[model samples]
Target: MPTREDPLVSFKFGLEIEGKLTGFFTQVSGIGSESEVIQHKVVNSETGETIMQQIPGRLTWTPVTLKRGVTSSMDIWEWRQQVVEGKIGEARTNCSIVAYAQDNTEIARWNFENAWPSKVVGPEMDAGSTNYMIEDVTIVHEGVERVS
Candidate 1:
């Protein structure tokens, strides 16, 4: 069995997002202003070692299909609204990313389960708020034998 401190250990990864982008929005930065960014952060949950942190990474949404086999949830709407209105604490912006490291080398890629916006258009063409809802993030660790 692999110990927690082993050079290679298992990990679960995910992300958080907040705020919204509306119509006629122009790209000031990132993939595009309307485009959401999913950021990621990694830590050894058991050991508490900071593994990695990815910021301002892009996350795009496309039609759900059998090939994708996933659905977006409407869970984070309220929370996202609070975050955007400055009524809540700091929330991770959309699609920011981070990776994991082992023995000073990068070792894992984190991905999300859901791929659609949590918030929909509000009462009147208002850009709906979105809370960073992280789900089913995949953590692909480098196989031990592959390490040099």
Candidate 2:
């Protein structure tokens, strides 16, 4: 008999910076990368058949977006300010995205290096609606690794 694999659910996750908990965000996205494809033509000496070969050129990392309910915390805002003031060198740091299992135990983790916020969008205001306000922060990083 073969055993079945149980996939971990993604609803429970948090962000951490330098081993400090940033927050358990409402949504996280864009944890991915792409490789540039280079095609080359190879001619066969005997058959004269041309073959198109695809090789990877460069790797491009995608920007990760984090979203959460609006709170009094100003950490994300302050981090973005550093970039706005041309202090990007100070802004870059390592952070981790941690995913938890059903019992709230960390099941997986992805770490980002040289990370900084590229954009921060505040929640929209509406006096008539009684919904929780959400803010978004987009971050770009030089590299990423799965720690566990």
Candidate 3:
């Protein structure tokens, strides 16, 4: 019999860029993939009725977005600048997001390949209001998989 384990908390996770621990993020989303549905119509042999069948087409990966408090590091911005400057080929790199258990033991790791920042947004400014300066960067990748 297999022993049950509590679900790992996502709050304590880290993002690694090019195999190095980058920084802490408040939120990370868009970790998914979808297939394009292809429809085809066929005729029933006996009833001669038209029937539609759904077929899975090309697979598309969702862009992963990372959000965090703005810090002194300009790495994320520099990475995005590569895309903006038409140097995307140089921007592509393998990255990983690691989830940890309560005691900070590594629980799960999501590895992505050929990832490049597609979008990066800086925090909005308001003089009278006080809020943590946040920034978000969305990365598009060829594929992602969870390995251990």
Query: For candidate 1, lDDT tens digit of each residue in 1-148?
Result: 8757655442321222322311111111111122455556688889999865646665443321111112344434544565557654333323322223433343543223323333333322225745332222221111111122
Q: Which runs in model 3 stand beyond 4 Å of their true positions?
A: 1-5
Q: Which candidate's lDDT is highest?
A: 2
Whole-model lDDT values for every prediction: 0.32, 0.92, 0.89
Candidate with the greatest TM-score versus the true structure: 2
Candidate that beats the other on lDDT, 2 or 3, i.e. the better one? 2
lDDT of 1: 0.32
lDDT of 2 by residue, 6-66 (tens): 9768777788887899888878899988999999999999999999999999999999999
TM-score of each: 0.19, 0.94, 0.89
Q: Residue 121 error for model 3, in Å?
A: 0.6
lDDT for each residue of candidate 3 in 19-123, tens digit (9 for 90 to 100): 998887878888879999999999999999999999999999999988899999999998889999999889999999887766778888999999999999999
